[model samples]
Target: MNIPSDLKYTKSHEWIRVEGNVGTAGITDFAQQELGDIVFVEAPAQGSAVAAGAPMGSVESVKAVSEINAPASGTVSAVNADLTDHPELLNADPYGKGWILKITFANTGELSGLMDAAAYAAYVAESAH
Candidate 1:
């Protein structure tokens, strides 16, 4: 579980990297490993509103289809179109080329409630037990 110190995490497995007023969102490494061999991804259209904890997109793997929820609220600014054609990138690089969406946050203050690397690592560990 590689949780970067710079990002905040959601209990649902989404990670948010806030840069200025924009945020890059993706599934955590633990999430990708669990999903297994991602085959497809469905992302929200640009400029669409996304509410915190709500479904932002979906990821389909050999095991099952899982919804990728919003880690925070915002208007979706961009989606990684590469995933539509090469979904395996998610399994190969869950934190990099696999990033799902970029959003312009509705309220930066809401970031205070998100988990840090330590907390998210603990959450992952506890869930495994």
Candidate 2:
């Protein structure tokens, strides 16, 4: 899996790149591989308040529909409108253009609970068995 070392990961397989108090997030490479070809992404509305670990949106793949959970609490500042036209981006470049939403964090302290790239890679390995 392409787990970039700079990002933080959640047990649910989402990854977030934090910049200041804002965070850009998306499903991990491991998640996209498991989901198969992504067909649709239901991103959370802009300006919505989301709590840490809560269901924020859903991604529908050829194989199944999966709920995407928030990695941290914040107000959603933006949603990637491109996904509405090209959900394949999630499978093609999940860590880059496939980002689902950007949030202005409510509490940066919650970041301490997230895993670094190495930890997440190990977690994925453990789960595979």
Candidate 3:
């Protein structure tokens, strides 16, 4: 439940931190918690093109495997290589060291479609029942 106010959130439980035209994407703290103990992360290759809402990677947990979607259309500039060997970081610090990918987005305007921290918190709360 560590929803940082500055980040944008997708309904699927991904968060994006945009800086200039580059966006850092990751599963939300709520997502990591729901997935349980993360055992593996399969990230898209660097330079890959991903569309908004498309699966860019996947995370495997002790309980189940879940797809990680892109929050906006972009060319993936980097992948969090550290997660391949240390998937537990997703559970340890999802918002910081556990961030999954960085993309050079085609349009910053698409960001308006995402939720802010307050809206996302309410969305998560409503989904709980």
Candidate 4:
């Protein structure tokens, strides 16, 4: 429900904060709440190519395991290693420390396909009904 205004969102509930040509991405607050308590996470290796809308990682929760899709095409520049030890961080701070990947863009234009905060909030609202 906490959709930050500055970041772009995916229909699948992922969020990306763009800084220059790099983007830091993670599941949205709405996603973590829906997934329940996160128990484990897996991210793409550094330097790996991630195509937009493809699986870039996964999150395991008490309820189920969910594949995390990429919001844009890029090469993964960094992956959060801390997730191996403390997956609960995804539940605790999904937008901050819980970020999964830092990717250097393959095409920044793909960002135009993503939703803004207001649209995502509205999408979540409509999906609930």
Model 1 alpha-carbon drift over 4 Å, by segment: none
C-alpha lDDT of all candidate models, in order: 0.92, 0.96, 0.94, 0.94
Summing lDDT over every window of 10 consecutive residues in candidate 2, give the lowest-scoring window: 43-52
lDDT of 3 by residue, 40-74 (tens): 99988999899999888899999899998899998
How well does each candidate superpose onto the true structure, as a TM-score? 0.97, 0.99, 0.98, 0.98
Stretches of candidate 3 above 4 Å error? Answer: none
lDDT of 3: 0.94
Q: At residue 66, what lDDT does model 4 achieve?
A: 96
lDDT of 2 at 87: 100
lDDT of 4 by residue, 9-45 (tens): 9999999999989999999999999999999999999
Which residue runs does candidate 2 get wrong by more than 4 Å? none
Among these predicted structures, which one has the highest lDDT? 2
Which candidate do you rate higher for TM-score, 2 or 4?
2
What is model 3's C-alpha RMSD?
0.6
Number of residue pairs clashing in candidate 1, backbone atoms closer than 3 angstroms, sequence gap of 3 or more or interchain:
0
